[model samples]
Structure formats: C-alpha cells, structure tokens
Target: MTLVLDPLSPALLACLDHAYIDGQWLPVTGSERLPVIDPSRETVVAGLTGATGADLDRAVAAARRAFPAFAATSVAQRIAWLERIEALMQERAEALARMLTLEMGAAISHARAAHVPFAIAHVRAAIDVLAAYPFETLRGTTATVREPIGVCGLITPWNWPLYQITAKVAPALAAGCTIVLKPSELSPLNAIMFAQILHDAGLPAGVFNLVNGTGPEIGGAMASHPDIDMISITGSNRAGVLVAQAAAPTVKRVTQELGGKSPNVLLPDADFETVVASGVMTAFRNVGQSCSAPTRMIVPRDRLAQVEALAIAAVAQIRMGDPLDEGTVLGPIANQAQFNRVQEMIEAGIADGARLICGGLGRLEGLSQGFYARPTVFSGVTADMRIAQEEIFGPVLSIMAYDDVDEAVALANDTVYGLGGHVQSRDLEQARAVARRIRTGQVHINHPAWDAHAPFGGYKRSGNGREYGLPGFEDYLETKAIVGFA
Candidate 1:
C-alpha cells in the first residue's frame, strides 16, 4: 500500500532538504540528493540532500561558539530548558510517531507505544538526573567538578530513529553540551520533526543541530573534526570501527552502541509454555531490528521439542502488514539493503543443516511488494552456525539446546557480542545468579519492564560506553579537580 502524509504539516515536510544549524533552517549545500523510500511500499516518499564538509564546519563552529555560555548556565536553567523540550515533545508526540512509521515502516501501534514513549522517557529521565546531579563536591582541601565536555557529535541509526536520537540528545542537553547530530539518511524525516520540536522549545542557537547524510560523508566528518569534544554513535560494528579510527588522531572521547547477537536462556525448570512464547516475541520485536534483541534462544536439551512447538505457535500469531494499520503487529524491514541481508542469513541457516521449524526465506506469502521477511524459527541451531553467531537484525530466531546450566551460560556468551541477554527462571535467586554470569552490559530476568534509568551499552565487540539515565547524562561531562579550594 502507498503511504500517505497528507495530514502532516507543510513546515515539517519542508525540513527534508534543509539542515538545522544555529537556530535556522538552511538549504543543504551538497548537490547529491538521496531518496527516502517508504519501506512499506518500496516507493520514494521524500529526498534529503547531504550536508557538505563546509556545512559540517559551520555546524561545529556554531556549537563551539555556544558551548561556553551553554555550559556555564545554572543547573536550574538547563533543567527548565529540558522541561520545555519535554513538554513540546509531548505536544507533538503523535506527529513524531507517525513520521517514524512513514519513514521506517514501524507499525503505528509500535511506534506510538514503544518508540515515541520510550524516547520521551529519555527526556524525562534526563530531567530527573539533572535535578539531583551534584556537579561539585568537596574532599578535604580539594573540590571536584563535573563540567560539560564542550561539544558532542551524535550519530543515530534508522532502526529506532527518534528513540535513539532522544537517547543521546536529551542527556547531552541536560549535561550542558552543545550538539551536532547526523541522523541516518535512510529514515531522517522523524529527526527533522525532532529538530523542529527542539527549535519550538526555545533551545539556544547551536545547542542542537540536525544534518542528514551518508555515514561516509557526514559521519566521517564529525568523527575527525578537532572541534568536536566527543563522538557517540549507535550503529553497526563496521561503522563503529570507522568512527573510532577517524577520531583516534583527535584524542577525543568516542563511545559506541553497536551490534549484538544477544541470547535468551530458558532455565530447565522455568515455565516453558509462558517463557518460550514471550521469548519468541521479544526476539521478533521491531521486526527484530533492535541491536540488543535476544535472537538466540538457548534452552535445555531434553525439552527442545517442547520449546520448538511453543515458538512455532508464537510466530503464527505475528500479523505482518501495512505499518499504518493499527492492528498490524509487524511491518516491513526498514530498508531494502537490510531486507536483502536478512534473506541471505535465513538461507545460510537452511544450508548449514539447521532445522527450519517454521517460516523461511522470502517475503510473507502475500507481501510481494514490500521488504517483509517471514517470522522464522530454526531448531537444531548450534552456536557455531552463522545464524546463531551473526546479528541478522530481522525476525529470525535460532534455537539451541544446552546440557546444563554451565553449558547454557557458555552458549549464551559464545558470540563475540555482549550487548544484552535474558535469563528465565521461577526462582529469583537462580535467575539473578544466571544473569550475573551472562557477560553482557545488561541482563533482563523474566522479561521485566524496560528501565530508562538503567545504564545501556555493551561489553565486548558490541561496542563501548553507556547510554540512558545517570551514566548517559554523565557521559557528556568531564571532571576537574580544583586543588586548595578550601
């Protein structure tokens, strides 16, 4: 179905070709314009011109100019600004959520329920952190101060466009750091709406800027720019590596939230009927685009058949269709390239002798036009298999069986990624014990409610540093010790 934005404001649509710099919308300098496709129908909906190196220079300069004044603002003043941004976001929440569905093909319900609300929670989270944060403390005759880290370059991904944007932007604003944001070119319209929200909220000029372009062009420029104090990116492993390499010469602080092949371990004694169904849904959330999605399901060896049956039942219930449909549970893959990658991974699973319990390569039976992959489940998946080891970033689940608890932990930690993990058990202590043993940045016991306050990042090749809540807020600040202060 062709997606329509007839109800959207003209001003928001006008933001497509313009970059927000120093409180004004200026036409992008680059002549090359990239088409933004509506993944639901595989049609061009809008186009964005890339920001040139010169544009990056101007953005950096504006942020640098604003940093000193912004950084020196009173905590109360910054808090008030954050509150304003939060209120404006709430006022425009529906528009922001709809933009997400149009650009990234997220189900309207999912966009409204998880994407927008979770993003708003980050702003609220920043407000909470800023209210009580102690910027200065005394020790003997010395005073320790946490100050803003000048300017930050933020790069967000397309999978969770607005969610990832606010995850970094809100906290950085709260910490008093000026920003230059390069949102994913693939799904950038929501980001433009976000820029408008910040503008209307009365954010100081240069405090938050949005530039849309390719990773190689805009992202590369931001990383190597000397004026940028820190670079935080949420993207792929390859992209993270390139950013770190580019920023190495500047000696700037670089933080990344990259790829994951996170595992969901089902303790032998756990309620299989309940946990297996929930596990299948968690892995398939967002059409399985989440970096921290638990795509690997590790279960007891003997109950493999039972788990497989439960998984098949859950997959059958997922309703994949038009993202605009309120009842649709799953939407198309966010873009064409990702759709191709997912198909290849599913083919690899079959070729490697993994049992395809349900679903497989190609689009859902009737979804011939859009980028839709069948919700797939594979049994007899060994840890060494490519499907089990790689981050498919689609609705593909790999089920592996373990002989014991030690084996279960080993299976869960087998991959190079340590971004997120899940442990399920009726016994709270046992679940906690297993959670501790899983070598990931965050572990969820029995699929608990998402805590926006918890620090989120990675442990291994998944990338470094944290985002969300206090740690995320502090990541934008630097420490200084004033000796002889007393």
Candidate 2:
C-alpha cells in the first residue's frame, strides 16, 4: 500500500510515503534525516527520511529508464493524464487540505481554497493549454516540433506546497517529461498526499519521484546530476543561486522562482482606509510567508498619517492561533528560526528609526509556546531601511511614503526582487501603465483572479523562469527545426 501521512504532528511518524526511488518507496542509508516541525505548536510533526546520494542515483536511474516511454506518450494521452490528476486532486481536496494544515501551519480555509485548488487548477490549466498549444508548427518548407526536454529535477518550497509543485510538475508532465520531486522537508506531508493522488490516478511508476531532504544533500545532487536534463527550483534567492551554480557545470537548464520583496502601491486618489486595510491584511495573510506578499506599501507623502491609521486598524483584526482554528487568520511563522528571523528584522526596523505603528515584537499573548509572531507594522519607514529592502517572510508591513506616482514606481522597483507587486487604481489604463513600469514577474491589478493560465515567475533576483500556462509548458520542451519537412 502507498504510504500517506494523515495524523499530522512533528514526530518520527515514519513518512507515510517515503522518497520514491526506482519505482519504489525507500529510506536513506545513514546520517540523513529531516525533522518536520509543526510551526504553529513548535513541535516535531515527523522525521522525514532524507534523500541520500544513493537514493538520488536510484531516482535518476529510474527516471532515465522511464523517459523513453513516458516522453513518447502521445500529446493527447499526456493531456488526459494531467486531466486525471486534476479530477483526482479535486476528489481528494479535503484530505490534501487537512494534511497541508498539519504539515505547514497554513490556515485550514486558505489551504482548502488556495493551496488545494491552486494545485488542481494549475494541472487542469496545463491540460487546457496543451489542447491549444502548437505542438508542431509549419513555416514554409520547414517544420518546428517542440519535444520533451527529458528527465527533470523539481524542487519546491514549503510556503505554497502543492501549488508550486503542480505549477512545475503539471506542465512538465503535460509536455511529456519525466521528473523527480524534492519537496521541502518542512512541508513533506502534503507532497506525499499529492503523490498518492497521482499513484491512485495510475500515473506510471518512475514517471514521477519524490525525495525529501535538505538543500545541501539532495537538492545539490539533483541540480548537478548529469542524467537530469533540467532542474526547476522555487525557494530563496540564496537557494536559487546555489542551484544555478550546481547546474552550471553540467550546462543543464536551471529555472527558478525565488524570493520577492513585492510592493503594494496605494494610489493617492484610492480610498485610503479600504486599500491600506485590505493590503495589510493580505500582506499578513499566511503569516506573511508568501513570496508574493506585498510587504512594502508605497503611499503618497501627504496621506501618510491616514494610511498608517488604516493599516494599524486593519492588521489588528487578523486573529493569530492554531492553523486548524477557523478563527485564526494568521498562524505562527513556519518555525523557530523564522520566528527569530522576523523578530530580528522587527528590531532592525526599530533601530533604523522607523516608527512602530502597531503590533510590535514577541509572541502573541496566551500562545507563547508556538512560533507565533505579533503581526508587526512599521510606519515612517525610509526606502533604505532593512524592513523595506529585505524579504522578511513574516507578517510585518513597512509603510513608505512617496511624493508622486513616479516616486512610488521607483520605490517599487528599487529592490533586487521583482517577483510580484499589487496596485490599487481607479483607472485601468493608469494601473496598466504602472504595472508595466514595475520590473516584477507578475503584477496584480485590483485583486484580479489568479488565472492559472497566466505565466508566473520573477524578472530579476526573484529568479529566472516562468511556470503555468503556455509559457510554463514551453519550459519543458525544446524546439527542433526540420528543413523541407512540411
């Protein structure tokens, strides 16, 4: 029987589905293991059997063997398999949601609607895009055929869990590529559950593999492996750089969706109360662990006081507690290190002379055991301040005032990260213009629906690569031009 984790806690629960290697689930040899922490309760959920060099070798070997058959699958069949994954994930949404909550401290509601749906939606969208995708195009006497690259190494982060995995895996599978998945140890439970859905859907063994471990051992191995045709990673800028470096020698394609210090620009004419409030709440949503979270809010200088007032009032409403608690809008940081990191950044913000508007440092009252952080907001923050420049990965908002739209755009583009940005505007044209000016991979205009058919990635240090939609499918394929073929 396929192992699937259900009774979630951070103890040695023997991974429900250990790393899948050589078409079978297996454990590491020695000196390799990862402790999955329940971020909300600051306790061990499970000890994941980490991937070893031998495990990586086995997975890579399996993928190589499965590649010829899997890649030769007809486009129609690939699309059908992707569709199967979508339906199966939808059928098992509740279980996936529950596993995600226990694994990563994501709110149950968010996990259900955002996490689970995101994964399913991306897979289905890939199927849809594949239907319309120009697999073989003719130009004059020449024909161009886009074929699968080969066996792939996929590394996903913990924040969004399955959402990121599907974004990579779905499109690659749709393009007829085999893959090995390296999910974050912090959120391994969800990956296992997702894999079970795939297995149940009858995905051929070796077509997909899952190896859980730290970045140094398994991640590095996957990146540098010669048998692996390409590698995709979604993580921090530091991690992205490391992956790229490892893959450089092998000359393998390395695509990354990394960190972001995204900006939220509240127009001068925009309703200050509603915009700032919503922006802050969204920023702190998921305890501000999102890579696309607009941690910095750029407002007009004259409206600084008004914006600050609304932001403080808004963030105050988010209830922080257990991830399973329906009342809790914000849970603890993913772990102790993250909590400490946020605390240190909050202190740095204070030291830099930024005024604390509300919710300062330390754990929430009555819940001192978990990794809870008092949702923090810093006002009177300058552009050069650490809080405004760095990706804190917490529910801390930095308020920065700008003289005009030009200044706001500049401030928004100042950071090395260009993953995502949010803009509130009354005029569509103006928002579009501002969106173009921002150098981010994605710009959300007026809380637009996250269409899974759109390309999502970063422009700069946020990392290079796009996932989702047609562009995402293209990443998994290589085009070959045949002369006089048409």
Candidate 3:
C-alpha cells in the first residue's frame, strides 16, 4: 500500500528518504534501505535508508559545533524555543497522531489520546522545568553551579516512538544541550516530522540533528564517540549493555531505561471487582509494549478464581482489529519478531504447566493477516514459569497466586527487573507498606494519575538513571564548585 502523506508539507514528507544532518536534509548514501512495515496490515508502508558512518561523523561534528553557543544561551531563550516547539506540535497534533497510527500501528484513539498528547506534555514539562530551575546555588563558602552537559547522543526505542523522542530531546534542549537523535528505524517517519517541527520552530541549525539507521551503525557510533559528552538510551537490556560497553572506552556518562517484568500486587483487602479488570487492561495497554507494564498479576491464592474470572472477562472485552478502526482496543505486536516471541512464550507457559484461562497461542480468530495475537491469560502461574519470569512484550497476563502478604511482596520483587511495580488495596496504610517492600524504581499505590514530574528509571538489570520532570532535566547537566567563592 502507498502510504499517504496528506496535510504535511512536501519537504517534511521527503524526510523519509534522507537524514537531517547539520540542519539540512542530506541524502543517506552508501547504506542499505530498510522497509517500514505496518504491523496491522503486515505490509511495507515506506522505506528508510540507514545512515552511513560518515553521516554519523558529520552529525556528531555539527552537534559539537553548536553545543557551546547553544549551551551559553539564556534560560529564557531556551524556554522560548521549547514553547515554540510545543505550539507547533499542538498545531500538527492530528497529523502526528496519524503518522503514529500508520507507522507503529497504534490505535487512532490511543495515538490521539496518549501518544501525541503525552509527547507534547514532555515539551511543556521541560518548559516548566527550565523556567524556574536554579542553575547556581551558594553553599557555605562554595559556589556550586549546574551547566549543560555538552552534546548529547539520544537513542529512543520504536515502541513509544514520539513519546520517547520528546522525553529525551525536550529535557536535553531545556538543559541547554545540543543533541543528535537516533530514533528507531522501524518508526522513522514520526521522527522526521518532529525534525520538521523543530526546524519550523526556528531552533538553531545543528542544535538538533536526526539520523535514521540501525542501532549498531548509529547508536554504537554515538555511544563510543568522544565528542558526545553523554548518551541516553531507552531500549532492550541487550542493547543497553552493548551501548554501555562501547561507551566505556570514552568514560562518557551512559544512562539507560531498559527491560522490566513488573508485578501488580493485588492485596486481599482490595476491591477485586474494581482492580482486577483495571489490572488486565493496564497490562495489555499498548498491546503490552510498555517496559513497565504490570504483566505479572499477583493475587491471594483464595481469590485466584475470582481474579481469573475478571481477567477472562476483561480479555473478552478487547477488540483486536485494524488499528485505524476506532473500536480496536488491542492492536498487533509492533513487528514480526515480537509476534514470534510472544507466541513462543505462550507455548512455554503451556508446556511449563501454567493453566491457560482465556485466549492462547496463534492469532485471534478473524484476524489472520496482521501480526495480531490473542489477548491471553494464564492462571496457576508459578513465579519460576517462563511466562512469569520473562518479558513477553505482548498482550499476555500471568496470574500468580500468593498465600500471604509477605509471599505477595516476594512475588512482586522476584524479577531481575526493578523498573515499575503496582499495589492495590482498600487499606491505604497496608498498600503503602507493601509498596515500600517492592524493590523497584517506582511503585503505584492504586493506579494513580500519570505524573510527568515523577522520576522514571529502573533499579537493577532494568537499567539506571531517571527520566521525566526535574530529575530528567537534571540528567543533562554537570556540576562545578568554586570553593573559594564566598
């Protein structure tokens, strides 16, 4: 199918075939072109050429050139740039949402509601952070100051596409750092549009750059490059380790937001009727692509049957279909590899003796063309089962039963990942106590509202550092102390 680019200007559409380097749309030469497939249709919608090593060199050099002046700009000037970018994003929200739905197979409603809007929130949040951030403070006889951490190399994952880009880019810019962004090649179109938005907002040339390519070519180079002062990545644990290893030679700061097998501890006192269904939907949100998705549902053994019933009913409510369709609550896995992985894990669950309560291996009935999978749930899941231990990254839930609150907390903290956790109970004190015991970076008491200001990162193999709000903005800065200043 020929992907339509309506409403967007001809120049922005042309970004698919090139890289934005040194503030210019330069042809991506001497590299293989990869096809961008629409997961819902299993068809190639567009093709993007990977950036060559030479392209990476030029992009990095450009960011290095722009860093000094950009970093020296007044905080007010940086805030204005972010505000302009946010305004442009708002004006083109519909088009951006359409790109997300088409390229990544996000449901139109989800694209409009979460993907696009939340991305804009990052820019706004950065603006808010930059407006009042104290760059310098006096402590006793010493004057300590925070300064931009030079040029940044940002690598974002395909699952959250636009959201991850803004999460990194906005804060870097707000901190007065120039950037070279390497967005996932699987969803390059939206990143191109974002480059156009930044361009139209009149951001200085080279302050922001884009290069589309595989992680090895662009991301590896960025991680190792001496000119890039810092590197941040939101991707798989394997990828994060590789980046960290490559960056070790340079001694550059490397921050990563990696994998997770987060747990949802549903305490016995909680409202099972209310929390169970919400837990099911939250685990399956974004088709379970979120790194922090609570796929492991921990419940009291006595209440397992009730939780299973609610989970099965919740799965029944999911409408898996064309992502463009308004009624599609669940879409296909983002790519074929993820689809295959999900199927293999589900098979492992069956072989390992976890009881299949609803849905199962293979595509959902009536949807054989796309990369779709059944919204599956497995009961009687032990903590050691592959379905419970692994990150499925699909619309699959593992309901593990626990005998007591201590065991429940143990199950919640069982994973090698410590990215996110969830606790549900009617007794606020009990829930708070349980939340403290879970060894994760962030814990939710009762599905609290998404807070842009909250620090987000992992604790163990889940990776290091945080993103969003003040912590996120501060990550792009360096500290200096003038000890003699009084």
Candidate 4:
C-alpha cells in the first residue's frame, strides 16, 4: 500500500522520517530502517531510521554537553518550561492523538481521552511538585541538597507511548536533568512528534534528545554510556535485565517499570454483578498490553460460575475493530510479535485445562486483517498454570477460584510480579486489610479512579523505583549531604 500522508501537516509528517537530536531534525546514517506499522490497518504508515552507533553517540554527547547548563537552571525556570510544554501538548493534542492511534493500536477515542490527557497530566504534575519541592533541607549543622542526576538515558515502552515518555521525561526535565529518549521502535512515530513538541516548547538545544532503533544497539549503548549517569526503562522484564546488566558496568542508577501478572481479587461480599464486569474491563483495557494490567481474576470458589457469567457478559460488550473507529473499545495487538504471543498464551490456557469462558485464539468475526484478537476469559485456571503465572500482555484474563480470604490473598501474591492489583469488597476496612497484604506496589480498592500522581512501581521481580507523584520526581534527583552547611 502506498503511504498516505494526508491530514498530518507536512511538517508533522516529516518528523516520522527523521530523528530529533540536540534540537535538530537529523537523518539516521545507518542502512537499517524500520517501517512504522499501523496496527489498525496492518500497513506501513511511515518508516523511521534505525539508530546506529553514531546516532546514539551523537544523542548522548548532546545531552552530556547540555547537562551542566541545564542542571543549573532555577526551579522556577524549569517550572515555566514545563508549563510551556503542557500548553503545547494541549494545543496539538488532537494531532498527537491521531499519530498515536495510527502508529500504535489505540482507539481514536482512547488516544484523545486517555493517552493524551494522561500524558499532559504528568508534565503538569511535575511542575506542581517542583514548584513546592524543598530542594535543600538542613539537619542541624548539615545540609542535604537534591540535585539533577546528570544526563539521563530514558527508554520507554510502546504500550503507552507518549504517556510513558512524559512520565519519565517530565520529571527528568523538572529535576533539571538533560536526557536522551529511546522510545520503542514499534511505536516511534508519537515519540518523534513529542520530540517536536519539546523542541517547539523552547527546550534548550541538547536538553532533550531522541534516538530510534532496536534494544541491542540503541538501548545497550544508552545503558552502557559512561556519561549517562542514570538509566530509566519501562519495558519487559527481559529487556529491563539487559539494561541493568549493561548499566552495571558503569554502576549507574537504573529504574525499571517492567512486566506484571497482577491479580484482581473479588471478595465474597463484593457485588459480583458490578465488580466482576468492571474487573474484566480493567484487565482488558489498552487491549491488556499494560505491564501493570490485572490479568488474573481471583474469586471465591463458590462464586466461580457467577464470575464466569459476568465475565462473558463483559467481554461480549467489547467492540474490537479498527482503532480509528470511535466505538472500538478493543483494538488490535500493537504489533505482530505481540499478537503471536497472545495467540500462543491463549492456546496454552486451553491446553492446560482452563475452561474457555468467552474468547479464544482467533480474530474477531468479520475482521480479516489487522492484529485484532478476541477478548478472552478463562475459568478453572490454576494458580500454577503458565497463563496465570506469566504476563500475557493481551486481552486475556485468567479466573482462579479460592476457598477462603487467606487463599485469595495467597493466590494474588503467587507470582513473582508485584506491579499492580485490584481488591474489591463491600466493606471498606476489609478491602483495605486485603490491599495491605498484596505484595504489589499499587492496589486499587473497588476500582477507584486512577491517581495520576500516585506512586506507581513494582516491589519484586516486577522491577524497582517509583514513577509517579513525588517519588517519581525524586527518582531523577541525586542527594548530597554537606557538613557544617547550617
């Protein structure tokens, strides 16, 4: 199919073909190129230059060169800069949303409603925190100061492309740290647009840079770069390990928000009619590609039949189709690799004796192309099963039955992951009590609205370091104690 570059302005379309480094739109000199596949259409929307060693080096050098001056900027100046970014993001929100929808598989509504606004919130939140943050505090005769952690290497995932980008970049910028961003090549278009957004926001040259390529080349170089004081990545556990291993040689700080097989424990007293369906919806949100998605639905064994019924009803309501459609609640898997993984996991669930409650391995009826998958729910899932233990990253939910609350808690904490989980109960105190025991970093009681500023990061093999609110802002800072400063 011919690349249709309509609707997007020439300037905006140009971003897809170039890499933004040191505030300049530069071409990738490498022979390798990656096609930006539109999951909605299963076609190449555009192609991006694969970052070569030279490209990574240029970006790192730019950030390193800008670090000293950028770090010296006043807190107020940083706040002002963030405010400008927020404004530009809002102004070009629709364009960015369209790019996100096309390059990724996010529904158009979701792209505008959740993806764009949530990302804008991160920048604003960083500004709010920085405005009141105490950068320096005195302890008797000593003073402790928080300073920018020099040039930061940020690698964000594709599931929530711009959202993850802003989550890391906003705080890093607010902390006065210069940065080089490497967004997932699968959804690199939005990141390119975001780079333009930062550049247009008047971010100083080299303050923010972007490189596009595979993990082995771009990610490895960023993680191992001697000048990159810290490496922050939001990717799979395997990818996180690679980044950590590479950064280990430099002994640089590393923060990762990796994979999760989080559980949604539906208490016995909880209204199954309301909570079960909501849990299914939550698990399947963003097509279940979220690292923190609650893919495991744990319930009292007696209520297994009722939970399965509710889940089927919920899955039935999901409209899987093109991301450009306003009614599409579920879109295609973001890439071919993920689609294959989801298919394999779904087939494995059936092979492992889990009852197929709603969806299974196949495309939705009438959708012959694109990477769409049926919203699947499985009952009679054992805690030890691969589907229950591993991260599916697709719209597949595993329903496990437990005899008692203790068993429920144990079931929820069974996996090595401790990213995010959901606990539903009629009694607030009971829910809170159960929430306290779950080993995950963030727990939702009765599916409360998402806290944009809440601290979000995992506790176990799910990865370390928080990524929201004050903790997120602090992640980009380094602390030093000065004796006799008082």
Range of the 10 consecutive residues with the lowest summed lDDT in candidate 4: 1-10
Q: Write the per-residue lDDT of candidate 4 for residues 1-486, one digit (tens) a residue.
A: 112223355665666555678889887777677888988778987766787888888988999999999999998899888999999889889888888888778988888889999999999899989999999999899999999999999999999999999999999999999999999999987787778778877899999999888889899999999989999999999999999999998999999999999999999999999998899889998999898889999999999998888889888888889888889887889999999999999999999999997889888789999999889999999987899999999999999999999999999999999999899999999999999999999999999987779999998999999998899999999999999997
Predicted model with the maximum lDDT: 1
Assess candidate 2 and give its TM-score to the true structure: 0.97
Ranking by TM-score: 1, 3, 4, 2
Q: Give the per-residue lDDT digits (tens) of candidate 1, residues 1-486.
A: 112223246766676667899998988889888998999999988877888998999899999999999989998998888898888888777877888888899999999999999999999999999999999999999999999998999999999988999999999999999999999999888888788778877889999888888999999999999999999999999999999999999999999999999999999889998999999999999999999999999999999999999999999989999999999999999999999999999999999999999999889998789998899999999977999999999999999999999999999999999999999999999999999999999999999999999999999999999999999998999999999999
lDDT over C-alpha atoms for residue 46 of model 3: 82
Flag regions of model 2 displaced more than 4 Å.
2-5, 8-17
User: For candidate 2, lDDT tens digit of each residue in 331-447?
Assistant: 678777788999999999999999998888888888868888898899888888999899999999999999989999999999988999999888888888899999999999877
Per-model TM-score versus the true fold: 0.98, 0.97, 0.98, 0.98
CA deviation > 4 Å runs, candidate 4: 1-8
What C-alpha root-mean-square deviation, in Å, does candidate 3 show against the real structure? Answer: 2.1
Provide backbone clash counts, one per model: 0, 8, 0, 0
Q: Is candidate 2 or candidate 4 better by lDDT?
A: 4
